[model samples]
Target: MELKGIHHVSAITANAAGNFEFYTKTLGMRLIKKTVNQDDVSVYHLFYGDDIGTPGTELTFFELPRAARTHEGNNSISEISLRTASDAALEYWKKRFQEENVEHGEIEIRYNRKALPFRDFEGQRLVLISEENENGESGTPWKKSPVPAEFSILGLGPVYLTVPDLEPTHKVLTDLLGFRREGSYLSKNYGQSEIVVYASGKGGPGTEIHLEERKDLQRERLGRGGVHHVAFRTADQAELQEWIKKIENTNFINSGLVDRYYFKSLYFREPNGILFELATDGPGFTADEDLSQLGESLALPPFLEQRRSEIEGKLKPLETKVKEQ
Candidate 1:
């Protein structure tokens, strides 16, 4: 089966209130879901995206009130890139970052695409890449977003993961996951070894995954502001099930079939141990809530209905409004 693109990338944050304000007010993404982690109901699982939380545009977080700071190292998702509508849009973000005094890197070129590396308040590594994609379309902007729709973020671009060795992960990507090896690029950003890129599906801006070699770095210490897993998109349930069947028979381990309420998911790990998930595209953010009322209230899956009151009472109220100190 053909993978469409990235489904969603999940990460962690120690501060729920801070994370909610950063992504919504500072970044202008719409909070499409307000729910608790199904496995751990005391903490929150927040979903942010374009107007209605489109699949490709999703960036989710699990609020960990006291998780340690994430240690940057090999075998972890290093950076996540988001698609910018145009070079003009990139400039808008630069000015906004400066005005807000947000920590950001200077604009640089990688793989012929212009990118600005930046970090959230929690120091989650992120980048905005400005490239010309004629086939790409910007997602619907939040009605109350400060950034205009023309300059709104389109969706997820390529994701970067640092691995100790390339050959093993490369084999899993190309041979097993059906990714096509594109060319490699070298820059001072990485060291002597060049970063290899593997393209999935039709391979547009949001369909690329870059693997960087960083053997000297230490193993990632899982905690707040670190990516939990990267998910690739399957068109629907049938294709997702096909992947589950393929993974179960392989040397790689898998989570089998899972019902995530919004989508069907099968989780597994690449050889390097960076968590990977295959998620379907159907029954999306609108499954339970309507477009107009999206993210207004807490949403619970069927299994968690009985404990809604308990969960809601435990979760801190996540206010999107930015309060001046």
Candidate 2:
């Protein structure tokens, strides 16, 4: 099946409010949705991204207050990439970070792309880079964000996954999902070997997937600040359905046709234990709210209407405003 690009990335966070502030006020993403975790309805499942929170632009978080601080080892998400338009946008971001007193490392080149590495409120590594893509499409303008329309993120970059073995996981990405081997590298700090894979496209942050080799680290526990899943986008519902058939033909169990409010999703696990999802891009976050006021309040899927009050009550309130001293 032909794929369009990434759909969204879901990560866990210890403090929902803090994560919301960092992504919206600091990183300049629009808080596009406020909802509850489907499985664990007690916590808030907040989403941040471009206006209307288009498929590829979404970065979701699950709030868990009592989860332990996870050590950054080889088996966790090393980093996530976000794409920018040009070198000028990169420079603008550099200056913006400086003015905000957000510590960031020097701009550097990796795999021939320029990237700026930094941490979020919970130390989850993130990078913003200017990688040109020929077929890449720009996201909807979020007028409320401080970032100008010209500099809004195109989409989520490939999520980095650290695994003990590469061959098995690589098989799932390439053989099953049609990703090609782009390059490989070694990291001194984490003492891990790495491989980079690219989907067929003009390569950019969201297009390149990185796999790290950490043969000795223990498996990760899913909690706050952990990644829940990485979703890839298909051209349309027909294309997504074809992928569902392909997955079933391969003898892998898949959660078929689950309605995720905005998009229909199919969920399954790759070989390395990372949850992978295939999601459709139509009827997006804007379906509920006006494009202007998305992410401004709590939005629920129609099926969950009866439980809205209970869900809201269980979630800790989240706000984008800075706290008064």
Candidate 3:
């Protein structure tokens, strides 16, 4: 019962409309699903991914209109990495960011790969990594993306987590979650501490997590621009059930076998307090909408269909129209 790569990383955004614009128009990813957070029907939970909203490619956000800016520190999902075609793609993004007035760092190598770190308008940390020699699952870019298909953002790469200490989190990853220790890399910023790497099934950038140990920082105060949780992919309900039993065996408090409609999930926090989710890959975004019409309108799951009127009345209308190329 090995877990696949990342399923999705859910983050917080204060402006649903602005977040929608940045992710779809700026990043050129397809808005695969337009829905509200299941736990809180009043706010939007938007999902962006490749053409068909493939499991590992999804990057989601939960909108909280009045959320405070994130106070960054340790014990957080520090940075998110998006994969692109090659080092030339990094060049394209660097030039694009400059032209768009997007804040970004110069392209540099990190962990033997070219990367360009940048922040969204909300100050959400993100990096684009060149997938020149990377392995694991390849991403399917949206053909109609504003950026050319060859240079478009493909999928999630290695997720970075910063914690005060590493031992506890390391144990949870290597022992409890079945991730293999893939060695460590020296951090250019954090003093003396080496960033450790862990890989799940098919071990590659797509399935890896880069963990940074930082004793110099405080616990993160999460709000807008902060990552809510990162989910790993499981094959189906049966494997998810196995993971549920496995997690239940441990002392970690977990939400067992949650039917997310699009996917089944189990949520828990690692030792460092970073939320982790194990999600199934089946019954995907296509369950409710046609491929061509995804994200064109708000979608609700069966149970929530009855409350659609109440939910729609609360959320501010978000324009999901895409400009024709």
Structural similarity to truth (TM-score) of each candidate: 0.96, 0.89, 0.98
Choose 2 or 3, whichever is better by lDDT: 3
Candidate 1 clash total?
0
Output the number of the lDDT-best candidate: 3
lDDT per residue (tens digit) for residues 56-84 in model 3: 89999999999999999999999999999
Ranking of all candidate structures by their TM-score, best first: 3, 1, 2
- Candidate 3, residue 147: CA error in Å? 0.4
Q: What lDDT is obtained when candidate 2 is compared to the true structure?
A: 0.75
lDDT of 1 by residue, 1-325 (tens): 8887788899999998898888887888878888888779999899888887777899999999989999988899988998887777888899999999999988878788888889999889999998664365456777777678777777788899899988989988888889999877875575657888888887876888899888789998988879999999998998888898889889887889999989999988888999999999879989888887777788898889898888889988876442222
Error of 2 at 253 (Å): 3.2
- Go through the candidates in order and give each one's C-alpha lDDT: 0.85, 0.75, 0.92
- Please give me the total number of clashing residue pairs in predicted model 2: 5
Worst 10 residues of 2 by lDDT: 316-325
lDDT by residue (tens digit), candidate 2, 80-160: 888787767788888888988776877876666677887776767778877554346656656677677687766687678
lDDT of 1: 0.85
Ranking by lDDT: 3, 1, 2
